[model samples]
Target chain A: MKQFFIKNRISLSVLIAFLIFTGISFFADYQPGKAISKEYFFQFFKEMIFFLPIMFVLIGLGDVWINRDKVEKHIGKDSGLKGIILVMLLSMAQVGPLYGAFPVTYLLWKKGASVRNIFIYIGAFCTIKIPMLTFEIGFLGWKFSLLRTLVSIPAIIIIGIVMEKMVGKKDFTIKQP
Target chain B: MKLLIAFSVIAIVISFIADKRKTFSGIKSGMVMFFKLLPVIISVLIVVSIVLFLIPQEMIIKYLGEESGLTGYIFAAITGSVALIPGFIAYPMAGMLVKSGVGYSVIAVFITTLMMVGIFTLPIEIRFFGRKVSLLRNLFFFIAAILIGLFISLFYNL
Candidate 1:
């Protein structure tokens, strides 16, 4: 039981927090905080319900489908600028939370992707990619979409350069700490 | 009460399956992770709801309407930076902004940059990526955000 609790600390913490909040909410006055809390509770659950299946499938694919070695051959640091663009494209293709990109980025690092390229991947993951921007342009407008993409290009390059200078080539490795 | 009962039943069934499959570790750990995320999840919800309730669309339009000059620009960026909504939420919000005499350019800049740059997630990003990288990334993003805003403003102004 102790081991189980330790292992599931994240989940357990959430459960405890939820229960505590619920209890407090029940007794609390009808202030803005309480009202907002009540609304949030429902909204949080709704989003979680919507997001979970997608999260799980992505997790499963990470474990089974992706071939880190295969990706590395074409996009490793040794491949230079070409490598960076390829890796950036791959990162753009990926879905899920931006954090979900980290493990994959770490793996690519081990395979010898430059720190600069890793920065590109991270930047691109956050910025609008082709897949998502299409919907965004339709929903919003083309000029808006185009401007966003334009801004992102330079941002990605600048981030790539900055990351290289700050982190250097020392920290990135295949070995898990 | 209804959702609580439903969730509890699902949780119980999941736990039972884990017990039977002897995959208790993964299932148990997943739950624990869920529990840990509870605080942030709740806080975000609270903030979102408050924004939704307290910040009226009319107020935003009066201040941030297309013809409002630089104030409109700053307001759009501030609103975009602080607001945390899914793309779906943002899309309709943008549509409303356009219809309400708010600049399409402003809406575009706000929605695009909002999704890309996160003020709320900064601490988390710093914790995960370290201060150096986070600072650089965010600084770059801020510039990108402003540029995107300016470009849209110019484009639609024409």
Candidate 2:
């Protein structure tokens, strides 16, 4: 219990801060956001609350479903280009806010995914996801989305290669003694 | 309303099943975990609001406007990185830029790098991933950001 509390201190601080801010916003004469409507605010909160369960389920399943050793073996340097591509694709499929990504990245580290590949995964998670791309296209236009996607692919690849060399060590993998 | 209810039901069911399975500390613990993230989520929202409130759209155009050329793009990418708006806000802002004659390519690069690279999240990232890994990753993304913009520009023209 103590260790768990220690590990989660930052998250707890953020939660406290959020509660205080929310309390102030409710009590004080806080001006609402301009572009965001009151209706939109409620709706966004509603969606977030609604999505929490799904997120929990996914996280829970990942804890059990993911094969730690196989995940590492496949993504290790010895796994070569195909492994890299697989790692990239899997990372791209991950969803949620940047912070939401950390738990999974930590899991991958525990599981033996290379730190370099994890960097690439994080980059791809940011840039190369299909849903994000589809949304970008829907909102901004196909030309903008396509251009962004094209650029991201090579950039993620390059980032992966460069980081792989510079880091001088793969992340904690099952292959490690 | 029905769709909303349906989604809620699905979420509840999933949560129940997760609990039943006793996985990852079950549904109640998961809910607690989810609530724990609320502060980070709220902080992100507050920061987005701050950017919108402080920075005028016109100023963004002047610096990141099409007429500004290569320098404009670099400025735009940096601005986008620092502004820290969500994609929902950023893309529309990019649209306004386009209507105001900002290059599509610049907006593309700005949004891409803005979402991917974290100038603001550096401390947190360092804590999570260690310094060298975080530094190398962020630096690589920053450089790739330039090429991303340039490539988008060419691709659209082609």
Worst 10 residues of 2 chain A by lDDT: A168-177
lDDT tens string, model 2, A111-164? 667756776678878887765677677767886776677768777877877776
Residue runs of model 1 more than 4 Å from their true location after superposition: A1-21, A24-38, A49-68, A94-112, A172-177, B1-62, B66-70
Across B1-158, the per-residue lDDT of candidate 2 in tens digits comes to: 24435754575566557565555454445455555545445445444444545676667766676446788777877776666555566667777777877777788768877787776555446555667777777777877887888877787678
Query: Any residue pairs clashing in model 2, and if so which?
Result: A112-A173
Candidate 2: deviation at residue A147, Å? 3.3
TM-score of each: 0.69, 0.74
Listed per prediction, chain B TM-scores read 0.65, 0.71
Tens digits of per-residue lDDT for model 1, A1-177 = 585557446545755775676667677764654755566446655765555433433333333334667666676556677776786777666554443454455556655567788777877876755556766787767767777777667777777877677776676332221
Native contacts, share recovered per candidate: 0.18, 0.34
Q: lDDT value for candidate 2?
A: 0.64
